[model samples]
Target: MANHAKAAEYNNTSISSLKGADRVRKRPAVIFGSDGLEGCEHSVFEILSNSIDEAREGYGDRIAVTRHRDGSITVADRGRGIPLDFNPNEKRYNWELVFCELYAGGKYRNNSGENYEFSLGLNGLGSCATQYSSEYMDVTVYRDDYRFDLHFEKGENSGGLKKEKCHYPHTGSIIKWRPDLEVFTDIDIPLEYYQTTLRKQAVVNAGLTFELHDEYSGETFEYCYQNGIVDYIKEIGGEKSFTEVQFYATQTKGRDREDKPEYKVKLEIAFCFNNEINLLEYYHNSSFLEYGGAPDKAVKAALVYEIDKCLRNRGKYTKDEAKVTFADVQDSLILVTNSFSTETSYENQTKKSITNKFIQEAMTEFLKEQLEIYFIENKAESEKILEQVLVNKRSRETAEKTRINIKKKLAGNVDITSRVKKFVDCRTKDLNRRELYIVEGDSALGACKLGRDAEFQAIIPVRGKILNCLKADYDSIFKNDIIVDLLKVLGCGVEIKSKHNKDLNTFDLANLRWNKIIICTDADVDGFQIRTLILTMLYTLVPTLIQEGKVYIAESPLYEIAVKDKSYFAYSDKEKVDILAKLRGKYTIQRSKGLGENEPEMMWQTTMNPETRRLIKVMPADIEETQAVFELLLGENLSGRKSFIEENGYRYLDMVDVS
Candidate 1:
């Protein structure tokens, strides 16, 4: 709860001998990668990784995350308690040193063969770095019949571990801490984010069991999957038209000489294809390869080669196109590629991958040889997959051609005015100092155009409802007249006429005419629909525009509380009610139904003034979810749209306008 400044004063340090702490603080990017939300997530990963490492060592199985009522999180694991033995000469218990120190875990020396093969946790700096970035932390260790506790504020230990009386038959460790408010500007961690991640981990770890409870919100859940990646494939693939199929294979060869035991390479690929377009792949190292490295390339190459060979032999594909590119066969595919190696030197302290290139090559060769035999023997399934790939190839070509033609027209500027004429052009040419007000209907558009900022403000009055971009691809999208005009006005040079087109300039290189695109719609269902349409287009075609902080939606008051001569604008019903209570005898409240009904001065005072206007910037929390929603709403599937509306209609905000 305390501001980050005080915490940093105690935690921040520049000592050179503290190698792990220095590395993390100096090159935080190397450890957590960024100072943004993703990097904050990395801190959670660091903690979870340590717990998982215990499981890999065959010492821990159950991990629980509890969100305290006060907003702090506790992560506890039942693993072999951290070693407490002391080197009499060093005179320090290893458990205390490891918790307070950096780069201090046993997996570094391969004490646990499971993790030595593949890991995804910090060497020693993870916990220490987390401590540095947190305001307060407490770690408890249960080892050798003794319970010990260490407390720290920032990074410095406030005091030594206090010997604790045994409370129960317990082992492993428990860490309770709150991230520093200064380092993490976001004080509230969304429960859904944690839920999504922990559920995913449970799915990936297979036999691992995880329990989570949020005391703040009274939410609790448990996750475990005995089938592991196979269950993951089914869950991610959802109700898609694909059955779970796992390809199992392995290979071995002597490491040094004939006397050496054969070093083995094991590979497991679980995959399924749906009726969608892009590919989804989850890679890991022995249940930890977060992203596949050489191992991935080997397996994919073999899989493609085998499928291509089968297709060609069955007279389904030509020998010329028999070399299948990974992308071609990945249409609507959900895949998991996991590999285990006895020897590795991955750059990451977490050891997420096996870097040895030789093992990758070996895996590829083994797959190519064995997969060829399997597919040849199971002729029916192989032919079906080959046919699907061909269909995907054709669809891809058509989409590309459409994209090219649209871009050509946009760049060529061949009178792309099917809708541009409807926009009320602004006279000013200066872009940075200017802004555009995109309003719904001619009524609100007329008010905005006359509100008198012609020198900087342009008004675009959109007709009826705009296109929902989710269901359409790039080609079908450009066909919408309203969408094309909006892009042109915004200085987003449209793809058109070939790059060499030297004639009448179609591309508007004129210094961008507006710096802000503000959506001002009526306070009604139709208005919300129009705003969503515009937002969808920006999300798909010009995501960078939003990311760069250029798009915003204007907040128009729903209720205009007019008591006698004085007027107060209320953006919500609650505000209107509160305002009415204060003016109990002096006023009669009037709720304005729409922007058009409000006089020019009232509109400027409540919704247009730079000082008073309340605007909401659209930020996509999950790109995948946005994409899926858009596809369902706009795609040709009427049933999907109906289902979505029925399921989520309750979430829609009620809008009111005083007319």
Candidate 2:
């Protein structure tokens, strides 16, 4: 043993050097999740959200966001301009404090719902963080018959704020920032995100106008909503829903809590049933929460309870009839639930989820009252909705029975030693922590089984192309053995008996046997086809797999070039070129047509080892885009497919990035 006292000295150093803006620059991911395009794009979101919050308070009618060719994002809102009053505490202009100070804002005027109406920036770090992360920020505030111009570089004020006579006729603010390359390297703001976000905001803002001008794409879109949420639901649902009746309800509650006079709540709820719309675009205050929060949870519960109440009043169901569930109702429900609070709590600084119980309770009671009244008034529409609900309930009952029957056979046996034959199972008793690799051909399976970590990795050998769930019904899907084995492995059950006991629709991801379900195929065209088929099936039958980021595609190199003493794996022709440029001696390049072509050792070294292997996460960033591709490429229309292939076939040559 080495001497304890004289061992190599290790000193603990405190990072006191980091301050304000420097802190944001040092830890970019904590602020923006990445130093990539997402971070740069999110910076724009911070600015736009601040402007939209002003509009939320009926201060602005028009807001414009633009992406410059020189790589700057600018947001201008015709609202009460950023305040210029002296803040006695900071002994600085309020506008200066707004940009420079972290977590310094008026969003938290009240802890209760009294002043809950706000936007994306909740913590003091929001806009200040954006400022700190930016290379430079320019501001122009027009208010009180004066124009205030301010500029800052890397969170430091370039000069004092300047006040001048305002020749313009309007009162508002303009903010533009260039994302620092040192902080967010080579990142461009994603226009699609802003476009989608603006469209959503248009619906909720009602009369507000949203404009986007993109210099990179040379595209401009202006969005205005006269009908607000109603128009949005109609457009998204399209002809898929009963076009005649879309129930719209808006309500406000006076101070319900005597002790909490500030906890005032307001709700603007709109809903329509469309078979195609499975989207939940939930907003708290003004910030969009992708997964929803307390508001969504409350609305879902209220909807089920109220629907059941309506059914009982109309004598539509027997007392023994089962209560409706979210699974049965979600597909047909197109809902917009917006909650305004004077105060609210978020799960984290990300502000992705709201946790206020009051918003949930308020939404539940309000929607129930509105829905109950509508059901009583519109008898025919109520019957139409009830019939759909009943059909869904019956389907759920059949599915649950099917599930119970399967569980009865496999429940006691924690180790599925004799239950499944298609898969070469791993020794992992904890199903959720393991990984499942779906490979084509038994030969490929042999390679995976031999190369895999038997403790946590399992292999399933699939033959040819699997059934496309998009073209097949839920029941027909489970009848196929391939899908049945898959469902058993995933533990996410297939859907109800819509017609037969085959629909594999409903699935709970929590029960998934594998935390990561990877589709491992060859690096050939047929392999691509197999991967697409598998993805299409999962995208349709178990969409939550993709939504929850559990789905992945294993990237196997197409070519392995052994140059001199070193080996380089290239997935694309471009990569091949890049690799060849650095080679100095004779090289041998081997193209792998299938996994069978590679030996077990090679497979383990190149594609199976955790440190060396690459896995592409299948994220649901744009579900609509995914769905559109599925419809066009799957079995929807052949002629349209032909036209699309003829027009865009060459694009496939460069699609090496996808796999």
Q: Kindly list the per-residue Cα lDDT of model 2 for residues 3-118, writing each as its tens digit.
A: 66765655675335677688788887787767787777676777887888888788889999998998888899998888866878668788667887777876766445323255
- All candidates: TM-score: 0.60, 0.61
Regions more than 4 Å wrong, model 2:
4-17, 29-39, 85-90, 106-120, 243-261, 313-321, 399-659
Clashes of each: 24, 14
Over 506-559, each residue of candidate 1 has an lDDT whose tens digit, in order, gives 334343456888988987777888988888777766666566677899988877
lDDT (C-alpha) at residue 307 in model 2: 83
Instruction: Name the best candidate (by TM-score).
Output: 2
